[model samples]
Target: MTIADLHTLTGAYAVGALPEREAADFRGHLTRCAACAQEVREFRETAARLALAVAEVPPAALRVRVMAALPEVRQLPPVPAGARGRVVSLRDRRWRHRLPYLAAAACLVAAAVATGVAVEARRDADTQRDRGVVAEQRARVVSALAAAPDAAFHTGALTGGGSATVVSSTRLGAAAILYRDLPPLPGSRVYELWYSRDDVMVPAGLVDTKDPSGSLLLQGHPNGAVGVGVTVEPHGGSDTPSGSPLVVVPL
Candidate 1:
């Protein structure tokens, strides 16, 4: 179905008020169409909220009146005499036709509201995830610093590249990494931190202080690094060493 058709039926889809055939057809269309899917999601959200806000059922008298007013004309068996068209009052027919439209509009409004809520919920989840990453990095740094041979060395420099402050204990063995004063790497390269132990090098991780001279704090030292080294490598550090050392601090 075309986008215009979907728009016309958006309310019906939101309220689930479409005829079975029409509903099925629309569902098929939505599956293949991105725009319609988005519209349906929005409309459904709006419809749900409207339903809750209007929790009270229609008055019994109104319902009864509508039911009672249905045309009472009987349908006779197909025959020559029954073949003539029975004229339905223009006014009654018009009102009957308008009902679906009204219902659809209500559903559409509800769907819109629902979509908004969903978007907001997704945004909140993303923000929470970002915060979690930062917290996790902080923990790693704290642990590394604690692993330092000397507790005093656990302190990270805030001289300007980036700063590292111990967030938790490393008594169990972990080192926190924090430093400032270095330049930004090129697009094709990255700055990596490393820890050396007994001449064996252990890769730390990629860091981002953002400023060439800005103090960038990183997660702590590796499990057994006796010395700290910074190196430039491809965006991500390699398992085996590649590139020249940028800085080296002996333990």
Candidate 2:
């Protein structure tokens, strides 16, 4: 294929639809063309996600039915040694005409599976990298708040069990909460933090109920909030406190 033709093959290449020679040419081009490479990457990711969104599980009896019918299916008989120029049946001719298309379809299916696996792997790596960056930034904020000259600490006992410690730095305009020996909640429930200001509470962040003992840097600056409160909420958390605070530590 010409160079211009190779440039248009990104979509086909991403889906493994290119012939072997053309695909090889495009692969070489991709190494030197950053834009084409990026487009191909995006195309693959979109295709993979679309495939996953429409995928379904087959019925459990499907394999059994297929196996049962296999025994009754006829197989093509082999030709005699001297029958090279013999007339071919219409059925044989039809099968010959369809052979290439069937092979191509199989190749496409295999390519799609391979693309999905690659996309999932890349997504997982990106997620891990993002988590690491977030964790590092949180640690820095927590440390800075703890070291501030105006930092004040308050500890309160939770209503049902355990305790919560709040470290507030008015000068830094932030606070952090550390939960200790907190009891695990139901799978559908979670611990959410809030900042109380003028008797109005604003959501801070959600705590992982599975790890009862953990710490979180509240979502926003304290902004003269009176205290920090923890409460039980649905798994994704609530816009406002759904129930009374489990623990409230005055700032």
Candidate 3:
């Protein structure tokens, strides 16, 4: 999808209204686009306040009246792709993507005010905003791991099969890694990352090795870590190491 199309869905994404595929795509976009992430965060915060401001109950008769009116209403046909731009307001420079957002905003306002959906909507916005922050931070860490002046990298062979490589920057306080040619783990477990300090291992983050190879962002003290290790842990990861290292590299 175009960036503009993704932009139009920012509100929908903030409120969990996008279709599953589009929502997944937008979330992937969120990891790499700080501007979009920040926009989603702001929109979510505003949506939450709107939710809290609209706590009144609608009159009982209103639903009955709306249901009564539906049969007489005529539906408009879908606009053709070529003719869709005919409604543009030539006066506005930002008209390109505003229509969808305006429509989404109007729907949000109506839903929040009329349905009294404040609690659910506010909770979702808060959760989505927090996720945006985490995704954006991971993106920053990955970028720093690649671009920072103090960046360092180490590579080693994995147990059973394959090879692992870690790249990190002490100045940036983050690390990232890529792996190749590894066997997948069992359904009950996945790979998790850890760092070393003071002769002890600290849980740095986790990654899926289900594909047997992929990349992941590992934030927090990658720069200062004395070593890096990967282990097999339960899906949510263990607070402490739960298995012997599949790959270990002393930095």
Candidate 4:
């Protein structure tokens, strides 16, 4: 699974919402990604605290909804009949006296797992809310671009000898972008967008156009941008421009 998708499932895995096979897969990821482990620990603690405060029966409709959304849960693989245990080490023998503490730890883990289900439900709602907000923003950007007039088109040349155009509407405070002759970067590097005014450049966003040429929509125009700029940056981009922009289009 992609890293983002795996991150999304951390809450579900903490509460055992995943099938046995999928949970095992996430367990392997937990060993590698410390951030994911930290998230699970935090969410588990929240779940445990909320569980103690609530004793009400869950709505039947909620149960049906959750079950419908979940994938089929897998049963555990059977143990071989002839499998044998290894001889106990001296360390194991010494630890036998701590069985009571071990049992308590197991109970805590089970309780945390139970509370995690409730936490996952809340997370699902938040995720849906976030998605809705993003969808609405994208819709506004599209509408703004579609309504921009021909006189709004502005063009300029890149510092590295390429050309770009920005179709902008100051009234709407948005722009649509297209550029060509700009070479692509290797590996995870790509072009990032910026807006400049009064000689100060502000980041607009990033572009992931893999081909030699492409078009993009610029939403949420910077406060005082009189021009658009594009530069080479690391994959996700930076708060400030890393270097002089390779593409500069006057707006």
Candidate 5:
């Protein structure tokens, strides 16, 4: 695959979605590219985190109900030879007695399936609503910081490529970072912003990997912070930086 095409496989590789031949090629590329290697590590960690986040245990009641219904769901016996012309016998009566039990079991299964679908739909709706609210709040914060009278902007070069611009406002008590020409990270990795206070790095916010060049409104106030630092972190971000800053811009 071409170099540009290979770059796009970082996500697939991290999730083990790549074919054997393609994965081998990507491994070769990783040896020569420090940035790609770091991205791969971040992607793997992100995938693990996501797996844990969405995992759910089946309800105990559901299991119990399924087990209880198993005995009631029996297979009907085949008709005996020449039985079609005979009168209803004991075997026929027994089969007739099981009809209601069979119907009840089928209804129970249908009800369970309906309940599951309804629950899933409600959960998805709630999640979407929460995301919308968060996005709206973030947009307002970013806009306010941009328009603040005391806002000051500083630019710094990143380690591998591109540059970062940090905008801090004493009036708004907040900061924002704008990434320019930044390389895209794997789905499992994110660009994290930090506030440097007394040589200690505090996680400020996470930049979306999908939009590497987009802007992010940093969390917490920028007060007492000497500067802002940007680093690559796993999907969710780190409480403290895991490595040296890719770029640090004075506040």
Candidate 6:
């Protein structure tokens, strides 16, 4: 089905815990999804190693302890009909016949690597150029905020979670807000920042909550805004704040 649906089955697939239908779906997906298949194989190998770590003592009492600690095993899902023929062996003997091509490929790969390095060097240069532009823009905003009056910007504790701060210039009419000490959010939701100039509320950039120590950087100086707010919203956010504000640091 969908990637999210497939993701739900990853743990079960890794542990061979799926039912017939679910397992079959996972297997069918595995054929095309190299990344997921690799993860599953790695997880399976780790589990097998963990199982082997228990001491293999001859005492009959040891069996009771092992069985008691063991988690219930789920049945493997049925292999999809599309998963025909034997699994391809990583160490196929067919490669032996292509040693020459393999060597040629290796040389080509070396050349490609050199070419890649050159490409990356150019990209780095371009990135630096873009960063310079962004830095100039940021400097101008900060300078404007510095000149503005009634601008209060300081980091403070989160209501029940993390901490945030706002820097603004009521005179210059601009603000920059930053937040820290937030937990990661599930993929279903994203945290958003907002600015209120008097009665009208304007959106700030979405906060990145993927990090355990989340940080959000937003730059927007709403006209005639006296208050600011932060809220947890659906991904991509909305024109109006739908969810309750997690943090409200007044400017």
Per-residue lDDT of candidate 2, residues 1-251 (tens digit): 67776676665677676779888888999999999899778656543432332233434454554455444434346767987888889998998799779767766765665565557556665766676666666655665565454566678999999888787777888888877778888769988999998999999999877666656778998977999999999989999999999988999
Best by the TM-score measure: 2
- After TM-score superposition, the amount by which residue 64's alpha carbon in candidate 3 deviates from its true location, in angstroms, is 39
Task: List lDDT for all candidates, in order.
Answer: 0.53, 0.74, 0.66, 0.65, 0.73, 0.61
Question: Can you give the lDDT of residue 80 in candidate 1?
Answer: 57
Better of 1 and 6 by TM-score: 6
Point out the higher-scoring one by lDDT: 2 or 6: 2
After superposition, candidate 1 runs with Cα above 4 Å error: 1-100, 109-113, 116-120, 123-127, 133-137, 140-150, 154-170, 208-224
Question: Per-prediction TM-score, please?
Answer: 0.43, 0.50, 0.44, 0.41, 0.46, 0.47
lDDT of 6 by residue, 70-148 (tens): 3332233465787566665556547646766876776676666556555755666676667556555654454344323
Can you list the residue pairs that collide in candidate 2?
Answer: none
* Clash number for each model: 41, 0, 1, 0, 0, 5
Candidate 6 lDDT trough over 10 residues, lowest sum: 49-58
How far in Å is the alpha carbon of 213 misplaced in model 3? 2.1
80-151, model 4: which lDDT tens digit per residue? 556446666788767766865876776666566545666877776676667556545554454344333222
Clashing pairs in 3: 170-223
Q: Best lDDT goes to which candidate? A: 2
Runs of candidate 4 with Cα error greater than 4 angstroms are 1-151
